[model samples]
Target: MRMGFTGMTLDRADHLRRDEQALKLARMHPSARFLLLDGLKPVLAPDADRLLWVRRSQAPDNPSIFLGLDEEGIPHFALAGAAADVGGIATDARAAGTRLSAPEAGIVALARSLLDWHDRHGFCAACGAPTRPVKGGYGRQCDRCTAQHFPRVDPVVIMLAEKDGLALVGRQPGFPAGFFSALAGFVEPGESLEEAVARELWEEAGVRARSVRYVASQPWPFPSSLMIGALATADSHALSPDFEELEEARWVSREECAAALRGDGDWSAPPPLAIAHWLLRAWVEGQVPPS
Candidate 1:
């Protein structure tokens, strides 16, 4: 199954990111395009199905991040400040997925992640000194100690623990009413992906995972994370839900999950934009453990 934010079609020219002369020439290229953002929202073309790209001359005079080149060697950039009120409609990233093609959604993910990283990492973690953007916004350099830093993508383990053809699902306290999805947690330091999945299942739902298998992955750029999807065989069916981490935890059959995804049930599945939805769909269709 296709996941959101995974089909970027750009040729990320790493060779030009540090070459000032080459980057300058790229910026001046006649085919260069600029993607304008209203704050963090992406501005869509009038048709509202694609990103509204503007010539550099028509773009806002704000700091920009090089997003790489398309097939024709046209350089693409993204910027976030003082976008002109005219031209296109600005849509939240979460909602953009339904309206954009997979490749366009991928571009939004990369652009937003890079721009947000630059905004949040303007200082060196080691020296407490100001850091400047380097490598076309792919990294930063410390002003004081000359240390190099790169963007960080945190890993998150989202999984389903199956026993007797039923999958365990849970909803956090903050989740909307009647909404449940796959159990997930951040991958703690020094832990393997399989280890994290097992730990999260045990910690959140008091379920023991016997064996773990990779399912698929999706790029989740809310801030930035790699959602590692997996399926685990459960040792037993009993559950001891940890109320602190989950509002409720229970087992759902594949039919029940399919109904929720189809909007024919009392509960609503996670939206299509989320990896959780795809994971549930995969389980419902017996695509768990993948092919």
Candidate 2:
């Protein structure tokens, strides 16, 4: 199952950074566009299809982050400003569905992540001095220490544990009854993807995974995170919930998992855009080892 926000819309022209003429053309070109990003939300214009795109002057006066060039060779930028600055609707990036083109949606995610990084990193991490954006919003330079800082993406491991033709899915305390998805946790320092998968499964559900395999990955830019999807063979099926991360876990058959994915079963599952849905479907389709 292909997921949204997987495609790259911009060419990310790094060579033009030091080229004044090329940079000016990219900024002053009539074909260039700037998307307004307020914090993590994007300014969107509602259409009959509800696609999210708002046109502004080629050169915006506000401090803008230079996004990459589109396939047509048009430069794109993102400006962090108020929603009222434009007549369009300011909405969350998640609303970009069929209403918005896939490339546009992917760009929105990139804009949100970049703008959010700049928002929270106004000060130097090394010295306490104030920092200014450089490299077209890619990094910040500290005035006092002259240190350069770049944005970061957090990695999270979301996995499905399968054993004896059954999948282990669990939910937290506040989830709707019978609503369960893949177990996930942030990757700690010095931890590998397979190690994080096994550790998270054990800590959340008390399930020990003997072997883990890489499945797929997705960029979940809700404040910037890379979701690493994995599948593992369960070594034990002891029922124990951490109560903080999960309440209880159950082993559901592949047939029941299929019904849940179709939204016709007793329980509900994650949506197609979420990597968890793909991981579950892969297990049901026998793409993962089921011992």
Candidate 3:
């Protein structure tokens, strides 16, 4: 299945990013289009899943972030600053995902991630100096120290632990009642993916992971994260919910998990937009162990 935010069709033309003249010419292209966003929410068509785009003349005067060239070589740009009254419905990331197509979602994810990063990192981290966008919004250069900064994506491990046909699911305090999803944690420095998975499983639910196998990945742009989906074999079925991490944790059978995936049971798995849903579904379909 095509995961959400995975199939971006843009050329990303890394070569043009560094060429000031090329980028300027692309922006001046007759077919150049600009995507509008109100803060982090993307403006969409009022009645469809389509992203609402406008010509450069209609976009804000603020500097625009060059997204990339589309299949037809048409330059596409996203507003670097929040748009005030660009007529259209602006929706949050989750709603936008359901409304937009995969390619559109991928575009939105990239735009949002880059825009957010720029907003937070307006100054040099090494020295107290103002930074300016360079390389067509791909990097920032400190004005005083000449320090260079680029967009960073934090790695996260989201995994499902399985044992004896039962998978371990957990719920955070903020989760809706009866909603349980795969356990996840950010991949820390110097930790391997497998080690992160095992450590998170053990720390959150007291479930030790015997072995971990790669499943799939998703670009979660809720402030930019690459979720590495994995499947692990649990050494034991014991439940130990760490209030600090999870409000509750338990093991559920394949049947129960399927029901949750179908939204037919008392509890529901993560929404289809989440990688956790795919990870759990993969396990329920018996595709993880790989015979």
Candidate 4:
């Protein structure tokens, strides 16, 4: 499957070394440079502003976090505090019609997730004491118990189920009218990717699936989630959507999916930036099973 526009490919050849060196450098220099992220968007420090400064309340440890580098090898940093608010910044960016490149979007997602994690994990669960930033903001150290905490990325399973000549699609309650995509859910603690796919399919659409195969994965940093894509086989053609989870569900034909992709149908497919769009495209192109 093809990656979405916002997908990022950063060459972190020297990042590991840089992260190790930054700590010693930060302690020596009291006023060190920091990057600011308004959600997943980076706050660029140009000529006038050499260092990004954000409100202390937003990101208390702004100077300490490690914002990953871009494809151009520029290190981006997360601005703590109100700068982490995504919806507000996204609306502003949209209103200004500030078009973002794929790499820029990826940076924004990364920044937002990193800062959010720090905000929520100010105290250690092991000792209930204040924690300090460590490892270029990748980890935290508990003052009371010496417990270490690391940033977490939740895994989500998104799959396209097919059998015969029809593919399964479903619409969640909050989706735009007539919008339907592949079924997806978070992976439980003990479940493998395939098990998660099978479980989600049966729970949401009442379909039993077999031959679950892994596809491409995407870093969906809506608070840090890794989208695991897969293709599954459904043994039945029945439409039994669990209304509690989905507003509607059906078995759509490959031609119908193709029409939706082409914007020639009553229902439209997801935007190109979403993994769902790629999954459907792969199915329509016969890269996956026809159904």
Candidate 5:
């Protein structure tokens, strides 16, 4: 099966060896490279002179640090004061002047979230103690509590619900006109991926689903989230959209969905980079059509 969007598989191999090497490099070198991301988009050609270096509020003894990822999949470590501030990078991306490649954007998302986590998680959750970076910046160690805290990637479920020849699509109030997408939400605590999928559908669009099947997943490090793709069979299509979550919800026929995916219809869907676009395309290609 061909993976959608950039057609790049950020698989196991890409992250395996680089993580350890990155941590070691960070420890040995006092200066490192950093990338910034705004949402899924990355800010390229950042002005290194304007980076922000945050010190640990709790650990007065811990050195201030800089954020950066290495070419070998490792993140760089350095003491603070080497770079300027963080706003310039984000501002650059927003101004439409910077252009970033697909993989580069993905890596930037990874670096931004991981570094942000390191900055915020200077304290151990297990006990009221300060934590130090370990495992090449992948984890932290709490000296007082002897606990290890790893970076976290929250999982979100994004699904396309189908019934008969139509697929369910919805729109939140603030979405651009003529735009609709698969319903989605963060997986809550103590819920399996399947349960989260079903719940989000019902909560957002008032649609109950069955036969929830895992389709694909994407690393959405807008702030460290994993988007889990799924296809579900709608038990009923009576869409009473929850006004709080969704402004409108409805079923579109396969033909209509196909046109939306192709960007030739009255309505335009999300771009190919988003998982919602892939889910809609999967329906049009009959890869995940209604049973």
Candidate 6:
């Protein structure tokens, strides 16, 4: 039951990563696998369905990110920047899920997040000095002021609020028509996950959640976010969506949600790769409390 990007079995031994020579050895591993990103898009094999993992000799001089080692101690790496016309293969990161294996999907997510982090955080915030990758891509070090920085991961609360036999779903204004998903919002400063879930439900759909429970988490790498999946029991079953953020918000029955997840219903739920779809599936399958 591993989610798309949750089962990355690689050992990211960050504590033991000070040896730069070890990183060099990993890069030069005879059996090392490498993936390249042209900007944020992954370069794919021309005639294959998966990422084109090139050899050490074939990889670019500098990879934008370093993915840690697998169980076999074989290292994985990624090059970010522009898609090189390497062996006539290329594909956008968004399409990686459809063609790549689940583990590779996790690797792609890591690469994408690191790419966005490096792109946005080229300068240190503490002293506004230029920073370079250090500790095998685990973080950045500013040459001036000697400030160290780690990558940023934004926490987002995504929830399914249910009452009676129905769960609430909301559609953003710009989503494909009829498409709806669990209510989600970025956690504001100084808010707990439960508080964020409650606040988002209230702000977006005017639903007051009396209680909420954690479900799971997923790495949403479209510019780097960690989706905290949750389930909430509403204080009342009511609907008054804030039009600014939602085109429509309403309670959908369990049967309807079940069909939506299966792609058989007219309503469009989030895709299978998204955590929202799993949240909806959990609700329709009676995993929520008060059963």
Best by lDDT: 1
Model 3 vs. true fold: TM: 0.96
Each model's lDDT: 0.88, 0.80, 0.87, 0.69, 0.64, 0.82
Highest TM-score: which candidate? 3
Off by over 4 Å in 2: 17-21, 48-60, 97-99, 289-291
Root-mean-square deviation per candidate: 1.5, 2.2, 1.4, 5.2, 6.3, 1.8
Higher-ranked by TM-score: 1 or 2: 1
User: Candidates sorted by lDDT, descending order?
Assistant: 1, 3, 6, 2, 4, 5
As a whole number from 0 to 100, the lDDT of residue 175 in candidate 4 is 95
lDDT score at residue 11, model 5, on the 0-100 scale: 35
Per residue, candidate 4 scores C-alpha lDDT tens digits across 1-291 of 235424445433345434667644533343433445554444533332122343333344435465544455444345543333422232222211124455555555566677778878999989789998777777888978889999899999999889887889989999998888989999999899989999999999999998998777777756788888899999898767889999998889988999999888878788766788888888888776432
lDDT of 5 at 217: 84
lDDT of each residue in 1-291, candidate 1, tens digit only: 358888889988898897867877777788899887786888898865899888878887777788898998899989885445547888898888767898889999998888899889888999899998778878999979989999999999999999888999999999999999999999999999999999999999999996799888999889899999999999999999999999999899999999999999778789888889999998999877632
Model 5 alpha-carbon drift over 4 Å, by segment: 1-43, 46-99, 289-291
Considering TM-score, which of the candidate structures 3 and 5 is the better prediction for this target? 3
Where is model 6 more than 4 Å wrong at Cα? 81-84, 289-291
> Which candidate model has the greater lDDT, 2 or 6?
6
The residue pairs in collision within model 3 are: none
Residues 71-137 of candidate 6 have per-residue lDDT tens digits of 8878888876344546735576667765677877888888888877888888999999899988878
> By summed lDDT, which 10 consecutive residues of candidate 5 come out lowest?
51-60
For model 6 the TM-score comes to 0.94
Task: Please state the error at residue 24 of candidate 3 in Å.
Answer: 1.2
